[model samples]
Structures are given as C-alpha cells and as structure tokens.
Target: MNVSEPDSSFALVREFILLGFSCEWKIQILLFLLFTTTYALTITGNGAIVCALWCDQRLHIPMYIFLGSFSFLEICYVSSTVPKMLVNFLSDKTISFAGCFLQFYFFFSLGTSECFLLAIMAFDRYLAICCPLHYPNIMTGHLCTKMVITCWVCGFLWFLIPIVLISRMPFCGPNIIDHVVCDPGPLFALVCASAPTIQLLCYTLSSLVIFGNFLFILGSYTLVLLAVLSMPSAIGRHKAFSTCGSHLAVVSLFYGSLMVMYVSPGLGHSARIQKVTTSFYAMVTPLFNPLIYSLRNKEIKAALRKVLGSFNII
Candidate 1:
C-alpha cells in the first residue's frame, strides 16, 4: 500500500456570515430604519453628556466626573456593535474572523468596564450620603482617576486569555454566527473542535465579573438608601430619590439582559429572540441613559439649562 502522511492542514473558515434578526424583506426594511435611528440617538445622547460634563465647571464633582467617563464609554461601547448591525440590516452581514474577534474583544471589554464603573458610582453615592464628613477625603481627584483607570485596564485585560485561546481554535466547520453581534458563545460554537477548558474558563470569568460587581452595587445602594431615609429635609430626600432612581433603572436594564445571556453558555434561545434581547441592552440602553439622568435630575437639568441658556434655546 502506498504510504500517505496524515493530512496536515484542515480546511479553515475565513469569515462568518451573521444571520441577523429576520429574513423577511418587509421586516428587514423596518429593522434597518429602526437600527439607524437607534444608533443616531445613542451617539447624540452620550455625546451630549460627555460634552456637558467637559465644558461645565459646576458639574466637575466626583459624581459628574465619573458620569463623563461613563458617557464616553457608552459612546465607544455602542459604536463597537451598532454600526455593523446597521449595515447588516440591509445586506449580507459577513465579517472576517479577525474582525469578529476584534468586535468581541472591544464589546466585552467596554461592557465589563461599565459594570465596574456603575459599582464605583454607587460607592460614591454611598460615601456622599452616609459618610458626608469624610466623603471629600475618601473620593479625592486622584482616587477617582485611579478608579477610572483601573476599570479601563481591568476591563480590557479581563478576557484577553480566554479570547486569545478561543481565537486560536480551529474554526474549520460551519461559518454562520446566528446572532446580531459577534458574541463569544456563537463564535466558539463554530470551532471544528470542542473546547471544554476554554468554555469553562470564559464562563466562570464572565459570571464572576457580572455577579461580583452587581452585588457590590447593591450593597452600596442599600446603605445609601438607609442614609437617605434618615435625612431630615424633604428636599434632600427628593434629590436622592431622583438620582438613585435613574441609577437603579440603568443598573437593572444592564444586568438583567447580561444575566440572561451569560449566566449559562447559550441558554438555547432562538436566534431571533437573542437578537432582540441583545439589542435591548446593547443598543437601546445608551439611548435611554442621557434621557434618564439629565431630564429627571433637577441638578443636571439646571446645569444643562445654564449652559444651553446662553444660546437662548431654553
């Protein structure tokens, strides 16, 4: 018998074809308009927050500083996914493997950073309300800067090992990613080989970051609520309610969707349902943030009025 060396090279998939939401022509048209409008609003809303915080001196406190950084993050965060989604709504949504990996990396990193930033924000509120006497010292400029840097650094670094490992896997099978964004679960599922080790590691790390930061935010807010209830003036109580209510709403939207997605590997949701769920948090949340914080809070409203008043629009 003729001796044949084992086939050394495996057929590799060069790109992934993303089967986004609906296949109907009418529905796709509607979705295209919907996603386009949503992206515009996300950019405008977050950009406004960032500019307001930067230009106004009065809103330069620790709370606003963190908010500015968060708004900037939101801009980057939504941009990482929405543009591709917009284009996909109209035509074939094919992305190269390298492009898909970059999307996954930025998307995860920014989302994780948001979780940590939200916790830091809650801690800031707790100290301001419960430990007023020491709040200034506890949250100085340097410390706030440190917290921001840590969030960015840790967020970008958190999933590096898992992503690199996943990317290196042999994706020599099906090339269809059955969702809107470049999610890790879908990407991993396409590999020619099973990756129990990488899967376990990624899931464990994701759960830790999500639940750990969420719990910290909850604890901080509980103490803040207690301190707010003990405050003597009704005006002070109303102010706290306004700020805390907005924050709680944002937190719930973010974590609720995240838990459903990442609590287990895939949870067996259909592709359409997954797309809608992902869009709710990833695309819609950023649009709502500026509306919630600026329009509801009397302080932010006043600051915006002061700044915009010079143009006489208000």
Candidate 2:
C-alpha cells in the first residue's frame, strides 16, 4: 500500500541524495584518501586474522574461534557502509530507496550481531576463568558453533521488523538524506504521515538490543573479574587480566562510539556530527579491533608469525 497523507501534494520519493560532509573539494579529497587508507587497513587486518586462524592449529581453541568470527563480522560490519561512503566522497552519490533500505538493514543487523558476539565472548572468558573445569565441557566445539550461528541469526533478525516498518511508511518527499548512511533517525524524519508508533517501536527495539546484550556482557565480565581477583597465583591472575583486558578494551570502543552515534540525544539531527561519529564506530572501530586483539595478544602474535613464516611473507 502506498501510504501518503491525504492533503499532501508531494510525490513518493524514489531515491535519497546523501549530502555527506559539505566541505571544500580539498577537504573531500583528503577525507577520501584518509578513509580509503583506513578501509584498506581494516580489511587487511581482519583478513589476516582469519587467515592466521585458518592456518594455525594451536590457536584453534574456543577463544580464538570467537575471535575469528568477530573479526569476520567486523569486516562485514565496516564494509556495509564504508565502500559506498568512500564512493560518495568522490562523486554525487545517490541511493535508491531499495538500496538505502538494504544498507540500513545490513549495517544495523551486523552491528546488532556484534553486541551478541561480545556477550558471547565474555561468556567464553567467564567460562574459561571462572569455571575452568567446566570450560571445555560447556563451550565445546558443537556448542560454540551453535552459539556463533545464534549470534549471526539473532543479529540479522533484530532489526528486520523495524526496517520493514520504516520502509512501509509514506516517504512522500524530501529525498535528501542528510548523512552518509541511511540511519533510522533521518529516515524517520522524512515520513509524510504520523508515525509515532513505529518510531517508538524502533527505538524500543534498538534499546532492547543495545542495553540487553550490554547488561549480559557486564554480568559476564563481573564474574570473570571477581574470579580473577580471587585466584591464588599471580601468574594466573595476570593471564586472566590480559585476556579480559583485550575484550574489555574492544567492548569499550564499540559501545562508547555506538552510544554517541545512535543512542545519544537528537539522533540523526546533526548531519555533520553524525557523519564523524558514525565514522568512528563503523570505520575506526573495525580498524582498531584487530590491532587490539593481535597486538596485545601473544597467542595471536605467535599464530600470526607462524602463518607469516609458513608463507615467508614477513
């Protein structure tokens, strides 16, 4: 049904012109080069992790498995918006309504997946640290695979209803999307008719995902921390801290920028600010996650060396 306001004369919008960063050409070109470099690094960093995990057998434990999955998801997560954004930087980029909706779906879907993945990672850490005896039993290969599948499935399912509801609304005019991505706030602003119900539902769903998994992660790490502190050996405690520290660092980076971009006041209100904030979570986060895991992690570094040495690339 093509829903539109009865009294309005505006035609249905077929496309949205993403007016990204209104700046001088010199600035635009600089940003393009900067972002392109970051994107390349992000892909290579995450891709290298996947390759290392595939080639190295010693790192085939549950923790590395989760790390590999998270890296792959990070690649997808950043790629969902970065490439198109890069193209838009150099040209008058416009996206059809269908394309916009797809971008919105995959971007948020993958992001939601990260929330669950983080929680799962915490749970893995908790099991390994808090219940070492049962860690192997609880987080077995089959169960780990199932949990991985659950994260992906749940993440994709998380935002399906909200996107569908938004798409069905009568976006009858103002084809300009003031930001680089097809975010919910900007799209909601363009609805022709009253949509408070859907808007509220969308926000509720988003909060449920963000806060729900956030709480789970918090709980998991709390247990892990207490267990680590209680350990008798300094070596054991230091090892525990090292593992949890990397995961926590990533969790902080992901949720910090995300809350600023998506959950803050006046969401999608300021185009220029939104663009910068989104870049951090989408582009910067992905690029840094691999570095956090590999650089801080001796196991990952060893695996990387083995992988590189096998190929004689380094």
Candidate 3:
C-alpha cells in the first residue's frame, strides 16, 4: 500500500472511539476505581523497587541493575496506556489517530524491550549461577550498560516494523477499537480490510520474535535450574532458585497470557477473553512484578528497609 499518498477517495477517520470495558456508567465508574487503585499500586511498587535499587549499595550487581530497568520500563509501559484510558472512561471515550499511534509506539517499544531485557536478565542469572567466580568480571558495568542499550535499541527497531506496516493501511470504516487501550491486535483488526497481507506478515513476524525470546529465556532458565541442582548445600540451592523465581513467574505470566491472547485461534477468542488476557500482561503483570520481587526476595526487602530506615521513615 502506498502510505505516502493521501487517498481522498477513501474515507478518513479523524479519531478512534475506544470501546472501553463497559458502556454502563456505574461499571465504568467501578472499573475506573479498580484500575485507579491498580495504577497507584503499580507506580508505588515499581517506584519503590527502582529507588531501593538506586540507593542501596548492596544492589550494585547486574541482577539488580536489570531489575531496576524492569521496574522503570513497567512504569512507562503502564503509564502509556492506563492514564489515557482512565481519562477516557471519565470523560470522552475518544482518542485522536495520532494519539493512538503514539500510544501504540510506546507500548510496542516497551513490550519489545521487555522481551530482550528478560532474556538478558536470564543470561545474567546463568552467568552468576553457572560461573559464580567470573560473574563480576563478565557482567561488568560497561557490559551491563551495553546489554541495556541493546535491549532498548532492538526493541525500538522491532516495534518500528509493525508501526510502519500499520501506518500504510487505510482506516476508512469503523474506527472503534474494542478494548480499553490501543494495541496492535485491535488496530490491525480495524484495518484488516485494507491490507490483510501486511497485517498477517507483521503479526507473524511479531509472533516469531515473542516466541523466539520465550524459548531463549526458557533455555537459559533450564541451564540455571540444572546448575542449581548440582549444588550440594540446600541453602545454596534455595538461594539460587530464589534469585530467578520472581523473574520466571513474571515471564510465565507475561508471555503465557500474551501467547494465549495472540497466538491462539484469533477467530475463536472472544473479545471478553482478549480483554481479560490483555489486562493480565498489560495491567496486572506490572503490578505483580514489584510485589513478587520485593515480597519474595530478601535482598530487595533489606534494601528497601535500609533505605527507609536511613530517613527514619520505616
């Protein structure tokens, strides 16, 4: 499709009406309240995690560095979609095409970045667990920085492909996205008639990236588990398992729900199911990450305590 040419023959949609969770005022109000609480908790939880890692000298390792990056990304990820949806629920249920695209851009960027970041985190764990003596030299500050930069660069590049493809498609008919926020799935569905081949190709390419990262992460964790099992001390085994458990749980939740929502029979999936699964990865997972890491891990909790205690605020 020639995206550069503005075809006046085709109808142009000025804005997209987001079909939020519900049309009923009461339900909308309830959803607003519920999501408001989730958003607040997500911010607080992730913010605390980031601050704890930043301030604590004990968390100067590559693992915590990745955790801090994860927290920050989760904040941006949730902020990109949730805040706008909240406002729409209370006021106008409309978003400009530009706004929708921008939302998609940030969401896609962060989501893709997370896949790489998680893999990097798993690799970090593998190095730390499998080669404990060389962990420091291997995952040095410079190398960690490079890995983080690569995560962001790869994420933005991967996301650009879909955005470019979607931009080329004409959106002339109904502009109602049947979800609380703008996402690639609904967006592609909206323009399916204009460029089915492009949509299919983009979707297939994205699926490959997602599944490929999942397999890589799984393989890293498999090696990690094997290494952990070889340790004779029960305490050592527990500590090794504890380090990656939070990340593993999060990966399962994020990628599991994502696969269920997108990789399944798209025609058979109900809108309600998609909305629920979307909420899992998009909204719920962010909230759970900090909770899982902070509540389950001793290092983060001790760091949080130390930071809070320094101010006599704990």
Candidate 4:
C-alpha cells in the first residue's frame, strides 16, 4: 500500500476512475431508473418542504425555521452525490482529482452540518416540550438564525484539515475509487502511503461528529420524554409525542446508517454494503424526511396544502 518512501516526493494524481457497480447492462439500467426516480422524488419532496415553510406565515416560528433549513440542506446534500452517481451509471466515470476532493469536501461538510442541525432540532423540540413557559423567550428569531449559521460554518470547516492531509498523500496507479461517492474509506484505500495519522484523524472526526451529536440529541430527547410522560392531561401527552415523533424517526434513519458506516469505517463491510448504507442515508433518508415530517405533523401538512393550493390556482 505504501507508494512513497520517507524522503520521496508525493506523486501527482490527476484523476480517478469510479468503479460504481460491477453489474450487467440490464442491472445498471434498472439501477439507473430506480435512482433517477428516487432522486427526482427526493428533490421534489425536500423542495416542497422548503417552499411550504417559506410561503406559510404560520410556520415562521423557530421549529419550522430549523425544519426549513434542514430541508434545504437535504436538497444540497443529495445533490452533492446523486447526480454524479447517475451520470457514472451511463457514461464515463472519470473524475478529476480536484473535482474528487471538492466533492469530498462538500459531501462531508454538508453531512457534518446535518449532524449539527439535527442535534439543534432535537434541542429545539426539547425546549418546546420541556420548557413550554420559557420556550418563546429562549429560542428567539435572532438565536435561531445564529444557530443555523453556526451549523453551516462549523460543518464546512470540520473536515478541512483531514481533507488537506489526505489529499496531499500520493496516490499510485490504478487510480480507481470503488464506491459510488468519493467517500473517505475508498479514498483512503487509494492512498499510496500508510497514512495512519491521516486515517486516524478522519475516523476521529467522523466519530466525534456522529457520536457527539447523537449523544446530545439522545440526552435532549430523554428529558423531553420524561417531561411528556409527566403531563397532566392525556391529550397533552399525545400531542407532545406527535410533535417529537417525526424528528425522532428522522434522527433514527440518519444517525443509524451513519454510525454503521462511519463509527467503524472499513471494518467488516464490503464495497456493496458501503454503497447500500451510504445510499440509505444519502438518497433514501432525504426522500423520507418530507414524508415523515409532513404526514406526522399537521402544521407541515397544512403548510404544504397552502403552498400547493396557491400553485394550483396560478
């Protein structure tokens, strides 16, 4: 695996061949159609949520603000990889070295931001459910905006050092990436040197982002659950559960797949498993977010109706 000696200069790698799937033409066609439909629905679903949040004045509160921001993030997140994957299925799979790293940076950055945002969203729900009296004063418009901005900034900056370190490591011939996306594991495997330090850094950051946010979310929801259970009225309990249910489901879908892929990177999983797991979070989760949030929550559903109705009339 070592491509360079201690004193040797790093070799320049111009491009990478993405061996997306080693399947037949028919299988590729089937997968292409399946992913195309999934991507279309994902965009439409997440886009509707974003539009609904914008057009409806009723959803202008802190909760919906976070939800809208997350929906928008989902659109960007899925866009970072799915388009290239679809193209790879049909045509040349070659991606320039810069293009690969750019994809790597954005994909990981956006995903990191998602982890932060999800944690923040869970905290928002906790405040709303557990501290109803102080919720409005605590989560003001200004604070919500600040939190959203912080998430984006921190997310984009999270993997800067690791990406730089890994990018500098020389890549040898047979410059091929096994996975659909320019993921860290596959990218690491391509490295010409035994970059233990860089590999550790990447995995550490991934673990911290995934596990740290997950723990924060878990703690927030635990308190929320306790508060909800103690509510005096049965109707109050049901309402509280209903509001938190969608978020919990989304969190489950997101963090569950992430932990499996990242927490133990390149452990026992094969390339196919990695692709499937990554697709679940990258493609499937985005498609489900709007549905999960909209179906379970009356406000989101109503907002969608309002947005769609206006469109219909026009």
Candidate 5:
C-alpha cells in the first residue's frame, strides 16, 4: 500500500526498502564479512596512496597529484555506499528518503568525477610522453590544481539537476529497490508516475559522463600509443607503455562494467550480471587501484616503503 504523510493529498513512500541480496542468514553473514573486509582494505589502500603522495616531496608533481586526488576520490566513492551497505547486511535494509537520495547523489557524483579525472590523467600522460620538452611548461602546478578542482566541481554539478528532478517525483508504495544501491533503474521502476522525461534526462547525463570521458581517454591514449611506437629507443617505448599500463587496466575495469550497466542495458543481461558488474566497478576497482598503481609504479612503491619505514611498520 502507498505510504504517504497523513497531511498530503497524494500517496508517497517515505522510506525505501533496499532489496539487497536475496539470501539466507548464513549467506548474509558471509557476505557481510566479505564486504567488510573489502571495505577496510579499500580504505586502507587508497588512504596509504594519499598519504604517500602528501608526504613525499618527490611526488609533488602533476602526475602524482592527480593520482593522489583519484585515490582520495576512490576512498570517498567507496565510503559513500559501503558503510550503509554493511549496516544493512546485518540490520534492516531500509533507507529513509533523504538518506537514499544522499547516497545516490554522492555515489554517482564521485563516480563521474573519477571518470573526468581519469581522462585528465590520460591527457597528462599524453602530454608528458608525447611532448616531453613542453610538458613542464604546459602542465604547471597551478593548472593541475585547477583541473582537479574542475573535475570535482563538474562531476558534482552534472547530476544535480537530474537527481533533484528524480527525487521530487512521487514514489508510491512497495518501495523496494531491487539492487544493492539506490540505482536509477530500481528507483525509476518505483516511481508512481510515468517519468519518461526524468528517465531520459538521467540516461543522457550518465551516457554523457561515461561515454564522453571514455572516448576522450581513448583518444588521448591512442595518441600516446602512436608516440610510444614511433620512439627510436626500446627503453623509451617500454617506459611509456609501463606508465600507461596501470591507467589502462583501471580504465578497462571501470568503463567495461559501466558500459555493460549503462550504455548497453538492453543486451539481454540478468539482474545477477548487473549486481556483479556493479560490485566490480564500485568496490573491487577501488580495492585494486592502489595495488595496480603501487605494484606497477616504482616511484609509488618507493614512496610507500619510505612512509612505512618512517613509521617502523615495514
């Protein structure tokens, strides 16, 4: 039945029941343990990256700054949803209207910022690799800071209108979101009215952020690839590929799942596929990002070791 305020003329849902993983109690416990461990590791790994970058003077350059910002974003991204998810695993899976929208906003906004930052990072690498002589003059410290700020501002603003519109829409009873998070799909399904305009707007915004940034990253890396290939020294080529490799891996992990979820939803995929894909991009990617960067990057490893040694933890 519809659950609206007594004073309201129309019926509306005040809280949403997030239908998180339909499993037995034992499975829920196991999943909670798994997610809790994952969340802890994700936070620790990304936090370490930020600290390493902040403490190391050698890493105070544009590339490392971008890395630090991205790592911080990962921490925020995972935190925005994981804590509530962990709570729901052992407790009630219900979320108030305001809380649900807040989660939805932060999660998508942070994700959008990540996409922009990734593309910006690719551009930075492209400039550094392809135009080494002018790289210093081009990517200045002031400019790098500006770009990072722009990524965050744009990301946060991009979905504001769409989310506001969606939140204002009437949500009738049986307010059950099928997936784990307050995703647009499940929320859209719960809307009492046929909100085609709002749905289209959300899809458009998501597509623009996901596809637009993906294409930009692709183009930047394509130029980087050509520049690396044309280098006379094999060492130079290997170094170029090595620097770009981690970024590419992250891009693949993030965009692959995103395309499956947003860009091509009509691929006859199942809800399980959707959940798994979301889990990969949302939680798994953040956990793996620090490992991918630190393992592949000698500088990052050195910095991390330095940080650890200073604390006598290594």
Candidate 6:
C-alpha cells in the first residue's frame, strides 16, 4: 500500500479535531461544569489520601504505601485526560499531530503504570498474608522504593515503543479523532488508512502490553484469594478478604474498562459507549480508588481523624 504523507495529501491530517460529547451549546456548558466538579473532587480526594499517608506514621505500612502511590498515579492519570477534554469542550477541539501523540504518551504511561502498580500491590498482599513472618524482611523500605521505581520504568518502557512506532507514520489529511481523548485505537485507524505496517505494529504492541499486564494481575489475585480462603480463623479470613477486596474492586474497574475499551470486538460498540467506558477509568475510577480504601480501612480512618484534629489545633 502506498502510504501518503499527511502534509502532501489529505490522507493523513496534521491535526485531528476531537468531537466532544455534544455539538449543542447548552449541553457543552453542562458537561464543562460537571467535568470541572468531578476533577476538583478527584484532586481533593486523592490528595488527602497522599497527605494522610505521609503525615501519619501508622499509615506507613506496605499496603498504605502502595495505596499512596496508586492515589498519586490516579491524580496523574485523570489530569492527563480530563483537563484537555474539558478545554476541548469549552474551546477549539482541534489538536496538532504532535499534541495528540504527547497526550497518548502521558496517558499510556500513567495507565500502564497503574496496571503494574496494582500487580505489585497484590504481590505485597500475598506476602503479607501468606508469608507474614517474612513479609517485613521481604518487603522492606528499600525494596518498596525499588518496586515503585520499577513500576514506573517498566510502564514507560512498554508504552514508549508503540508511541515511537505511531509517531513515525505520516499523517496526510482527515484529522478528526472520533473519541474524546487521543485514543490509540482511533489513532491507529487513521494510521491504517495511510500506513498499514506501522498501524499493525502499534496494534500488536498495545495489545500485548494491555493483555500481558492484565493476566499477571489476574493470576496474582487468584493466588491471593486462595491464600485468604486458607486461613483458619474467621477474623483472619475476613481481615485478609477486606484488605484485598478494595484492591480487587479497583483492579477490576481499571482492567474491565480497559479491556472493553481496547480488547473487545469494536464492531457494534458505539462512540458513546467508548466515551463512557473511557471515563470510567480516566475519570470515575481515580475518584473511587481513594474513597474505597479510606472508607473501608480502619487505619486510614484513624489517620484522617488525627490529621483533622491536628489541623483544628492550628
């Protein structure tokens, strides 16, 4: 196939226009307000979690440490997509080719990092529950720091390959991105029309990263569930289940929407469905994660009280 240059021909457009939820003025205003409110709450909720974990020594455990990292990642993840989308709703929807690629780069990096971080959290739980005697020695402070670093490094490394592959393709024309954010799927569709080889490479690489990380998370959680069930004491089992349950809920929400958005058959799914599912992970899930753990966990509740009491003294 003759791949047309975006500059030379209309085949690959240099800039793609993102068609936000509605073309109507009233709906756009409403969406802008709604999204703004959600964004604010997400920031506050996640920020509180991070702050409480840092200030309170009691929350310095392995699980809380991981939760803090996850909260921070959620803030990054939501910020990358929501602000841009909100801006598009209020103003011009067109984004330059380079701009779109950058958006995908950050979004993909944070997203892939979340996947690995969740898996690491599961592993932490496994050791804490199944190997309590060795948990402290195994998941030491240095090891936790290294694990967090590895999550970020591995995530960026995995997504960078596809971003590079996608960037090399020339855009000719027709620069409208079908979805809210600069998603890889719609981005690849444009590439397919112009450069089939690059498109295939991007698709394969993205699929591998998404699927590979999800399977690892699933497998880790499976063993965790088994270990939880094996505990003799009822209280032990309940505590173990409670600890893993919140994480499991988050893992399911993150991977479920991701799989639906990327892995499922795209034949019958509408753009609206795509937008909604994308929001689940990009907007709603981030907000839910901090709330879920804080609400369910006793230590976090106590920390929040202490933090609040300290603030009152000032």
Taken over the whole model, the C-alpha lDDT of each candidate is: 0.87, 0.89, 0.86, 0.92, 0.91, 0.83
Clashing pairs in 5: none
Candidate 5 lDDT at 173 equals 68
RMSD of each: 2.6, 2.3, 2.7, 3.3, 3.1, 3.2
Clashing pairs in 1: none
Per-residue lDDT tens digits for candidate 1, residues 6-106, read 44565777899888886798989988898889889888878877877787898888999998998899999999998898888887689888999999999
In model 4, the runs with Cα more than 4 Å from the true position are 1-11
Residue clash pairs of candidate 4: 3-192
Better of 4 and 6 by TM-score: 4
In candidate 3, list every pair of residues with a backbone clash.
none
| All candidates: TM-score | 0.94, 0.95, 0.94, 0.95, 0.96, 0.91
Q: Point out where model 1 deviates above 4 Å.
A: 1-9, 306-314
What tens-digit string does per-residue lDDT give for candidate 5 at 97-116?
A: 99999999999999999999
C-alpha lDDT of residue 171 in model 6: 57
- Poorly placed runs, candidate 5 (over 4 Å): 1-9
Whole-model lDDT for model 3 versus the true structure?
0.86
Clashes of each: 0, 0, 0, 1, 0, 9
Q: How accurate is candidate 2 locally (lDDT)?
A: 0.89
Write candidate 6's Cα lDDT for 240-302 as tens digits. Answer: 888889988988888888878666644557878988888778998898888899999999888
